[model samples]
Structure formats: C-alpha cells, structure tokens
Target: MSHPHPELSSPPPLGKGALRVVALGGLGEIGRNMTVFEYGGRLLIVDCGVLFPEEEQPGVDLILPDFDHIRDRLDDIEAIVLTHGHEDHIGGVPFLLRERPDIPLVGSKLTLALITAKLGEHRIKPETVLVEEGQRQDFGPFDLEFFSVNHSIPDALAVGIRTPGGSVLHTGDFKMDQLPLDGRLTDLAGFSRFGDEGVDLLLSDSTNAEQPGFVVSERDLNEDIEKVFRTADKRIVVACFASHVHRVQQVIDAASQHGRKIAFVGRSMVRNMNIARDLGYLSIPGDTIIDVKQLDKMRPNEAVLICTGSQGEPMSALSRMASRDHQIRIEEGDTILLASSLIPGNENSVNRVINGLTRWGANIVHKGNALVHVSGHASAGELLYILNMVRPRNFMPVHGEWRHMRAHAELAKKTGVSDDRIVIAEDGVVVDVYKNRAKIVGAVQAGYVYVDGSSVGDVTDAALKDRRILGEEGFISVVLAVDSNTGKILGEPEIHTRGAGLKPDAFDDVIDKLQDALDKAASDGVNDPHQLRQLVRRNAGRWVNETYRRRPMIIPVLVEV
Candidate 1:
C-alpha cells in the first residue's frame, strides 16, 4: 500500500540474499513495460517495450522507459526474458540492444521471430535462446521457467523465477479464455504447482481488473464476424492490431466461408502475418490472401481487406483510407469493422477516423455498436481465481493504470491477502522481497524518453512546451537595426507574425512602441545587441498581451552596424 513520494531517496545497496524489483515503466500507464530484477549483483530484465504518443506529445514517434537506472550497469545483465511478442512487451528491445548487443534474448519461437524481424530492420543480429511453454533455463542467479498463457496473440508465456532470495511468478498479460481460438488455455494447473512449491511474490496483469466478470472468449466473436461477412453487399474492410493473429484468423475464416478473396494492407500487417504463417502459428488457405494491388480487380462483394489502424494511428492504412489519402478509397456501401479494443489515450483519434469514414457513406462497426471486439486481459473474476489459487505471500499488480492496480489490490485483499502484503507501486518505485515479505525501499529515474523521428531522448519537456505554445498561440518576430557606438535607434523596427490570428496592419500599432523602448534603453547606455533584442521582445510582448490578450512566442533580432 506504499506510494511514491518526491522525497523518496535512492535505494540502498541490495541486501545480501535479497531480490530487488524495480519497474521502469508500465506501472501507472498501459504501455512501455519494463522491469528489472536484481539478485546477487546480477540483473534480469523482463519485457522492454514502448508507449505510443498521445495528442499532447506532438511529433513524438514513441516513448521509451528510462534506461538510466541500468545504463552504466548494462554489463551486469544476464539476459532479457520476453513474455510475449506484443509491442508493449517487446518493442524496445532493439534500442536496449544498442547499448549492449550481446545480451541473450529469451522467449517463445513466435515471439523471438517477431523481435528478430524487428531487430533486422535495425541491422542487429541478436543472440537469442528460443524457448516454449514448458522449459527451464538458468541465467546466473536466476532460474527461469515458462508457462503457456492465452492472449490476443499466439505463443504468449508467463514466466516463473526461482532465486535464493525467493520465488517470483510474473503473469505477463494473460486471460483465462477457456475456449481460445488457438486451443491454448491458461495453465491453471501450472499455477497450482507453483503455489504448492510456495510462491513468495506474484505479479499479475491488472489491465482488466475493473471489469466484473470473466472476459468473453475469442470464440464468441466468430458469430458476429460471420454475420458481418454475410450482410455486407460491398467490399469489407477489417482493422485490427497487426500482431493479432487470432483476429486475423477469424477474418480469414469468415472471408473463406463467404467465398471472398482477402488482401493484407499496411506494411506491418503483411510482415507480421508472413512471419506467423512461416512459423506455423497462422494458417491461411491456399490463394486466400492476395496482394493489396489486386484488390481492385475483384468485384466489390468478392474481396475482404484486412489492415492495421484499429486504434486510428495517423499513418496507418485505415486512417489514410478514411482521409481519402490512400489507394483504397472509402466508397458508398462499404462496410468497415474495427476489430480491436481502443487503447486508453487513442479514443479521440479513433473517433476522428470514424467520423471521417462515416462522412463517406460507409457503415462502421466497433465494440460500441457491436460485439466485434473482446479484451485480451482477464477480468475481476479470473483475477480472483488466480489470487485464490496462487495464495502467494506477497502480490504486486503490473500492466495497468493506478486505478486498475488499486482495484486489483482490493481483489487480493478479498481473497485473504493482508493490506500490508499488497504492494501498489508506480513506475520507478523500488520494492525488495526478502524473508518471504516485500516492502518499498526507494525510487529511481523513470521519466518518459521521447523518440522523435530518427532521434531518441533528445526532445525535452521545455521544447515540447515551446512547440505547444507555437501551435496553440502563434509566433511573432521583431527585427531592428542599431548604432553600435552611439547606442541609438537606427530606424523603425520591423515586425511580422505567423499563425497569430492578427492582420498585417496589427504590427503598425506595436512598431512605434518598440522603437521608443529601444531608444530609451540606448539612452540608458544599453548598447549590447543582446540587450537590445531583449528590450524589443519585452516591449512587443507587452503590447500584444495588452492589446490582443494573446501570448504568442516573440523573437527579437538586433543588428549592430
């Protein structure tokens, strides 16, 4: 029940025979998941991922977990265990690898394949150890075991760590879907075995902890998808996460049943599907998927286009089509299905895309209008079941917002876990488990490291604030010529504005005031060009704020002749 405070000091040296856990990201937010486990001076990392940019983070490509905590200690790392292949779990691997390229990567076959493909783009040949649901490996002081878990994507795993300090089980984003499309059920029996062996610490997913009941099975969406295929008289377009193999399988099945050809749009969609198919995780019928270029050759009713942008990313294929900027135009009578749940911060963007598509006379179906999507995380009931089953000495809820984590902590209390035994921590908070108990020790630097185009960690908050001001308020520039020796005004100052919501003649009112201010500063012996520039900025800014009530960015340029 401890929360982070501004006065929390840096954690003390790791106690002898103790395991210290720190989450660099994915505690208070839903994305950029990473956790560092320290034992006997060695580090084991789990799930390095990235977060998508929100509306306020303009021009940001991605957000990464701050690696400063381990930047200098990279050589002490044993390995990085990837629990799944989702972007929020594995997206930051390549960036981390750039610091230390030889760290062994451990994950399932499909997960490894996805990351390998991604790393290939970075021109990095990684050293990886391929594992599966039932396997065990030892890395320095950490002994790892893997268990099968059902999720939106195939080959998801939950990891178990055994150390001299204690035994910890991390359920990396799982749900109890009894009738999963891939025939893989969450290993409840395996969890019971871990309980029998005594689980000192249990970290579970909390993304859906607020929901009241079990999550609807992925199989349940088949009937609704079939209905969409049967009723659509024109072309059908389905948008989902590029990594959702099961959803794509459902779309492929429905399209095949209705005798329609399918095409994969978006580069990520094509690449991920190709990897899944090659690894035997995705099954596509012969000639079922054709190139996107051939989409126009078939009749309207005979084609199904599956693409990305279920969350309405600006550059995604579905968003481009909605804006009429792509090759596939949204014509009348077109049926579009958004097959993925919306991420928390993407609601406005998704709504904008939906409005754009609706304006073109296309019918839209989504989680709100129809049961076209189901959550990939377990709900309250399933969490209660796991809490009762594992019966661990300490519990930590990961992979959710604060409210979701708080709700999950309450569920743990109801299942006989004491309030003191539950640790509700945010990103960068450090928790140490020893002698079968866990407590908060201190905190670390876990701020957002923005990724702009071809740049990482270079964009600062002050820069973003200036960009916001320019975008929202506007910009104004003032140029003046000055006499260096006499410290007198040479001529009238020139002013111009952009995006300031003012007319050209608006500068005429401020020019005289600026000249007078410059002359007064010069008479007072302020001959420095920098000082003159500051005077001009102050004078012009005051006039604008007083006259127009707008706080636009004002730049002053002074020339000394």
Candidate 2:
C-alpha cells in the first residue's frame, strides 16, 4: 500500500492522456466527502459533502472540504455527481454552489430533490440533471454511467467514469442488501461488465471494511421495530437521520401497523420526508401522518414522533428534548428509540443524551440494546465480492479512516490485486492514473474549513485553541492604566477570573508582580503599549500557571494616558 509522505511535493503537471484524482475530504474520516477528477484539463467532481463537528471542534457548526484546491479551477469543473441524499454525501452542495452557482448537479431523482430542497433554503436555484440507473451521460471528457445501489436511503447510486486514459468505477456508500426495503439491489452485474471492459482503477467505499461478513439486510430490522411498537406503552420517539428515507418508511410502517399517528420532528426531518413522499420514494399510509401540533391531541400511546439527532448533535431536536430545552417534554413512560447506528467519535455525546433521557424515566432503546440499526456500507465479505467482480488494475479505498482503508487494501490484495496497485491515501493526497497504473504523485491543502454560525472558513485553528482554553482552563483579564511619557503605572491593576478556580482577590498577589514586571520593562526602555501589554500578560500568566497550575487565557488591557 502506498502511504502519503510529508516530503511529497506538489505534483508535476499532468502527463498527456493522464487522469489526476485528488480527494479534498472523506479519505481519513467518515464525512465531508468530496473528490475532484481532472481529465483533459477539465474537472469532474463527485460527492461534495460536509462533516459534522465532533466534540473537540468547539463552536463549529459544520466542517467543509477546503476548496482552495479547486477555487482557482472552478470554471474548469463540468458538474458535481451526487451518489445519494445522505447529508455526508450531498450536504456541501450549497456551499460549493455559492462559489459558482451555474455549475450543474447530476444525481438520481431523489438525490437531486433532497439537495434542491436544501439549496432552496440558501436561495440557490441550481441547474440539475436527473439520471437513473443504467443511464449514461457525457460531461466534457468524462463519460459517466450510473448504477443502482441499495442503502439506508432510496435512490442511491454508484458511478462509472470512462476517459481515454482509463475507466474508473466509484462505489459511493452502498451495501449488498439482497432484500432492500425499496427492492433495489447493488448492481453486481454492472460491476462485472466494467470488469469485463477492464476497469483501470476502482475507488470503493471503505466505511465497513473492518467489519466481517455482509451487512444485515434492511428487511431484517422489521421484526425488531415491530417489537418495539408492540411493547411500548407511551409515545414512541424515534430518532434517525433526516435523509434516511427507507428507515423512515420502516418507522412509518411500524407506526401505522400499531394504529399510532406519526408526526415528523425537526426542520430537516420534515423537509426531507416531505420531499421523499412527494417524489414517491417514501410511502405513507392514508391519514397516518399528522401535524406536530396534533401530537398533543392524541393519546400518549397513540402517537409516534420521528426526529433527528440520533448522533446526539447539540442543536438537534432529540438532543434538545433530552436536555429539557424543547417544547415536547419526555414523560415517564415514553419510549425513546435511537434508530440509527452511532457514527465514530459520537459515542460520548450519544451516551450523554441516552443518560439524560434515562434520567427522565423514559425507556431507551438503541443499537446497543436492540437490533434497531444496521450500517449502510458494504462489509468485508461484500467488499471482497466486489473486488473479485471489478478486478480492477488498481484499487484506492475512499470514505473511511486509516484502519478501515488498510483493511480494505488487504481485501483487495486477497482478490489477487498486486500490492503495488493498492494506494491508501488520506485527504489532500493526489493520485495520477495513466496506462492502467495509479501513483500518489503529491498532495494539496485539504484541511478542515470550519463553519461557525454564519461564518465559513473564518474559524482558524488558533481561534479554536482559544475557545478550548476558555472552555476548559477558563479566562482572566487584567486592566491597568499607564502614563505614556514615563511608561509608569498610574493605578493598581484590576484582575478578574472566570472558571479559573480563583476569586478576583486571589489575583491580588499577581497584580503587584504584574506592575513590577511592567516597571522593569519600562526601565529597560520598552515604552511601547503593545510591549507593555505583553509584559503584563507574561507576568500574570507565569504567576497563575505557577500558583494555580492552570494556563487560562490571559488578556492584558494596557490603556495609555
């Protein structure tokens, strides 16, 4: 397996008739999936998405793929081909479209609809092309074909791209669920056809490569969901992904079977389900769906609520309810069903939400306790099967962490692919494919572009560090008045501390030390206000760190008179 090295320099210009591929995101992590394909000086993008913020990314709303790689080349782009409607697959469309609103979007009907609705909120009316399974379209030098792939959401697809240099098949997040709720199966025959035609490179989803055996079919969860409905005594609150149309269908069926009225919660949940319903992807029984306001009129046992926040996002509806911040209160007998698998790095937040709901006397049912959730990615067995089916000359694992990609590379090798043909790379790593060979030539800047509230790409690592310090170690501010001419302290410094485990009076000893340090700096001929502020900061920071063993954010305000 080829690994990216820090010493790797910017790749030389693309060789004649060569295809250059660079993953801006979704290489080492589970989300923010964006891949740029360059052929004949034009670009083809696949899956512009976003990554949900983890706990360490304080105050971050979303993490976007750094567009610096393509910001200058946006005009060379043909279109963005979406694979599915999941947030991790299409959530970044609006942001990317903001860069160039005229860029076309290509996807299945349902996928296009979901993104279109989302873009509507951003007031972006994008140009979209709807293509179904087995359809082929040419965008510049890339001839693309779509194939049906069953996932937790309906209308998922895998794409095949044909260029003069080579042909590539990208299996966007999919599983070989023989019995999908929508009756759509992964196109093994299509993969075999590509294998027959000689696939030069294969970029496959590696999210479940570490897990053994095929993923459980979506149909297998019917009995488990039915059991939850059969036993629950009060309102059933099901939390899942807003874009999970099939899972929502299952929840709707279960609620209908139990004669309970269902209401969608969360803005995203309501909007996506409405789109799925209107597009005929999600099936709803007659009079089964009710307004959220009507939820109050129904009996406790006669209502079902489907909301977002299965991942325990702080602002999600379920999270708000768990924290007693939402209008819908959790009763003693309510059944809170977390109907989704936990994304990695979300275990702590999910557990906190679970504990909060449990404290409210609500019965909690999650994947840990029940068979209510299954992954949508293909596992080891299915990956091996696809590897054998495609028989590509080169294999690159995408959409997973290092361990998962490494495990997938082993699977590719097991299928007789040469070790030299397997390239395991992280985000920003650039690979060039020519004459049936793929090599990691270099890398680009593919760092996280944080979204905090209305700000995009403005939150730097330094700002996040300061936020973390303020949250963890607390903050301290020192106010002092000094004479400009003599650089002499005119008054005693006033100190204040928050979350530093010290009262304002506790900083008295440090104030004098700070004044003395300022006097020394002034005597040393450092009369600059900025220099004096640094002196006070250093003195107070040293004193606090030494005395309280804490390094809080020290703000020194030096006023010149």
Candidate 3:
C-alpha cells in the first residue's frame, strides 16, 4: 500500500505557471465526476456530471459541481469531453451549456446520442463532434485520444489527454469484461500502447477498488436472466438502472425468449431504449416492443415490463406500482425482478419498496436472490492490472469515496507504484504536474450546488438543516397583538403549533402561562416589538423544552394597530 511521501507530506501553496489539475467533483465521494485540466491559461473539462441526493440533503433533487472557478474563464475552455452517457457523467452537461454555449462536445456515437437527447429536453442545441476508438483530436494546447472500454453502458471510453505539462489517462468507469454482450471487449492493447509511451498522470476510477477479484461479465448475467424467464409463469416486471443499456438489452432478449412483448414504464427507460435502438446499440424483434398503454391488450403471460426505481426512489415507476399509486398494480403470483445493484445508503428505501410489493403477494427477486446484476466497475485485481499497464509517474484516483480512492492507491502500490508517485486528493484539491515533479498544490472553491425543481445552487446548508429540524421536532408560531397607545397587551396570546410533537389541546396550559408572561412584560413597559419577540421566544422555548423534552423552532410575531 502506498503511504504519503515524506517530501510531499503537506499540500503546497499555489505557485505561478505550472500544469494544474483540479477535481471539481468525483473525489472523496461518488457521482458528479468532473475534472479540469489547465495548461497555458487554456482549460479542458472532462465529464461535467451530477450527484443524486442522500437522506441528509432534504428536498434536493440533484447536486452539481460549483462552477465558480471556471465561470470567468469560459472563453479559455476549449471543449467538454464526455467519457460515457451515465447520468453521473453527463447529467450536468445542460447546466454547463447554460453557462457557456458553443463549446463543442466530443464523445462516442451512442454517448453523444444520449447527451443530445438530454440537451434537447433542456432546449439546448450544442455543437457535437462524434469520434470512435483510435481517433485523435487537438484542441488548443491539449491533444485527446479515445479508446474503447467495456462498462454497463455501451460506447464507454477511456481518454488519453496530452498537454505541454504532461499526459493524463482517465479510465472513465470501466471493467475488464472478457465476454461482453455485444462481443466488444475493452481495448487492452490500446491501454498497453499508452503504457509503452509512459503516462505522466493517471486519473482512474475507484468505484470498486475495495471489492476483491475481478468483476463478473455482463454475459454471465445475461444467462441468469434467461433462466428466470424460462421458469417464470406469469408476467415479469424488472427494475433496473435506466442508463445501463447493456442490462436493458439483456432484459429485452430475455423477454423475447419468453414470447413476451416489452413495455417500458419510466420516462428515462422509454427515452433511452428508443435512443439505443435507433443508434443500433440495442436490437428488438419486430413488434416485440409496445407502449405502456398497450400492456392490457396483451395477455398477462405475454407481457414484460422494464421500469426504473431499483433504488426505491419514490417518484420512480416501480415505486408508484409498489405503493399502489400507478395505473398497473402488482398482483398475486407476479414476479418482480430487481436487475440492478443496490447502491450503498439505499438499502432501507429499497427494502421498504420490496416489503410493499410482497405485502401485495408479489414474489421479490433481486441481486441477492439471483445472479441478475453485476457491477460495471473494476475490482481490486483489475485495478492492479491497469496500474501495471499504464505505469503512470503520478496517480490520482477519481469517481469514488475517500476510502475507495485510498484503496486504489494501495492497489497501485502493489503493482510497483511508489508512494511518492501516488497523489490522493479530495474534491477541489489542486495537483500540479510539471515535466519532472508533481504534488498537491493549494485548493479551489469546489462545493456542491443543490438543484431543487427549477432552482440550482439556491438551497443552502442552513435551509436543509432547518428542514431536518422541522421533520424531527416540529415548529411553533406565537402571535400577539399590542395596543398602539396604551403600550399594553390587546388580548391573550395565540399559540399555534404543527409537527412540533405536541397536540393542540396539550398546548392550552402552555399558552395560558405564555399569555400571563406576555401581560407581565407589557406592564413592565416592554412595548418594543423586538424586545417582546425575544422575551416570547426565550420563555416559550425554554418552557416547551422543559415540559416536552424537545426543542421546536419558536417563531414570535408582534403586531400593533
């Protein structure tokens, strides 16, 4: 395992004129995988993406990388390079386009197809350049080469970027699949070719660094899906990731084998399936695909429904059906298959949906129950293989949590990479690689920008904390009217509470005590609105905490007429 180098023990202060690398996101965390490569005042961005919300981020729909660092240097941005079409890798492209339009996007045919569809939804028309494997392009001071890589999604690539300072090879979310569904294997020879030339810095994916051994192939998972189709008696409903085109293809093949028509039940699933089929990445038999509305037209045993919400997202089509809120409800003896990996931190929510479905007598079949899902990331052994192949002078792990990144660094060391050659970084930490030396240099403003509804970067930490408090303890509002001339209380104080863990009748005695306190304060000539509000909040809050053992948000209102 690689340890921190003694000479590079601490992050150095920013120096003038060096090759700078900044991770806007996808370091020390998962999702929102973005990085900025700077050379000679020119910027090249790789993978502007978004992160899904956790339980802590209440009311947040999505999270994006803060664009403050690049907002002023928009003109210097040469192009945006996309490695794949996953939401975490391409979801934020529209947001970036909103900031600076006319920047050309470069990626594989299918990757650009998915991104173009996404941009159309946001009413954006971007200049797109489609490239295949072995293609090379020059943008300003940067020269980029694309190579094929096998992942859960089709047309995924690993990028090789050449700049004046050094060269970086970014393995964008890949696994070594020996037998991929499309018979297209990862370009091992291409990775070796880059290795022969000597890479300066390698920013690799660390998503599955902690997992042991190599990942199972998508071909293995396809056979399992076929087995389930042969055994199932009734209609089959599968919940999977919408962007995983390979898994979707397997499901379509399985459905056709069982002589069933397929119906996509989610917005993303429907849209992506159409895009994949149109681009030749997905194959469907003639009239094998049908609309959701036509599901009733076919017999129960002749239909297969592939939807989203394997993670138990509330708004997903599977969740709606599980909760009996969708047009089609789960029936007795129906088979519900979850053909997706259970992402960390989503176990409880996924289990809740499973419980709901089982209560309606549906049989639950998931990755735990069957060999239906395989990860799209390289495991420890595969990471070691890549490290040995690339043999980069300096290494920085990306696209995983801190633990994953650290584990990847350890794997690199096992492959003969020295501690001094490994550079583990957090989000926004800048690492400068020169012709001979590389070290972490200073930091930048790389924070999460929350997206709620139509608003982006508007939700703050304080607001989310307040929402959590309200959810846990509730709130109280105290309304009082003051006499304008007499400086006296007009009437008894009105106390209203909601979700404060207290009933209306229970607050009667508390309200009486508060009214008396208000009258006493008024008699003492405390007619100032601010003073009265403070008095009410302090006394009412203290009394409530003492009596109920819980502190609710106390809001005091003073009105004079």
What are the lDDT scores of the predictions, listed in order?
Answer: 0.92, 0.91, 0.87
Candidate 2 local Cα displacement, residue 436, angstroms: 0.9
Q: After superposition, how far is residue 474 of candidate 1 from its true place, in Å?
A: 1.6
Ranking by TM-score: 2, 1, 3
Residues 1-561 of candidate 2 have per-residue lDDT tens digits of: 013457888888989999999999999889999999999899999999999887677999899999988999999999999999888889889999999999999999999998998899999999999999999999999999999998888889999999997889999999999988888999999989978999999999999999999899888999999999999989999999998888899999999899999999999999988888898988898899999899778899999999999998988999999999998999999999998998989989999999999999999998988899999999999999999999999999999998999999999999999999999988888999998899999998889899988899999988888988999999899988888777777878888878888976787698779777876776788777787778778888889889989999999887778
Candidate 3 structure, TM-score to reference: 0.95
Q: Model 3, range 1-561, lDDT digits (tens) per residue?
A: 011233433345434556788888898777889999898889999999999898888899999988987899999999999999999999999999998879999999998999999999999999998989899999998999999999989899999988777888999999998988888778889998998888999989999999999999877887778988888788899999988888888888888877899998899999998999898998989889888899878777898999999999989998899899999888888889999998888988899999999999888888887899999999999888898888888888999998999999999888887899899887777799887467886677778899999998889888888888888888999988887777677888788888887877777777788888887886787778888889889988988989889988998987786
Please give each candidate's TM-score.
Answer: 0.98, 0.98, 0.95
Off by over 4 Å in 3: 1-17, 484-488, 516-525
How much is 380 displaced in model 2, in angstroms? 0.2
Candidate 3 scores a C-alpha RMSD against the true structure in Å of 3.3
Worst lDDT 10-window in candidate 2: 1-10
Model 2: residue 113 alpha-carbon error in angstroms = 0.4
Which of the two candidates, 2 or 3, achieves a greater lDDT against the reference?
Answer: 2
Instruction: In model 2, state the lDDT of residue 457.
Output: 90
| Per-residue lDDT of candidate 1, residues 167-267 (tens digit) | 99999999999999989999999998988899999999999999999999999999999999999999999999999999999999999999999999999
The best-first sequence of candidates by lDDT reads 1, 2, 3
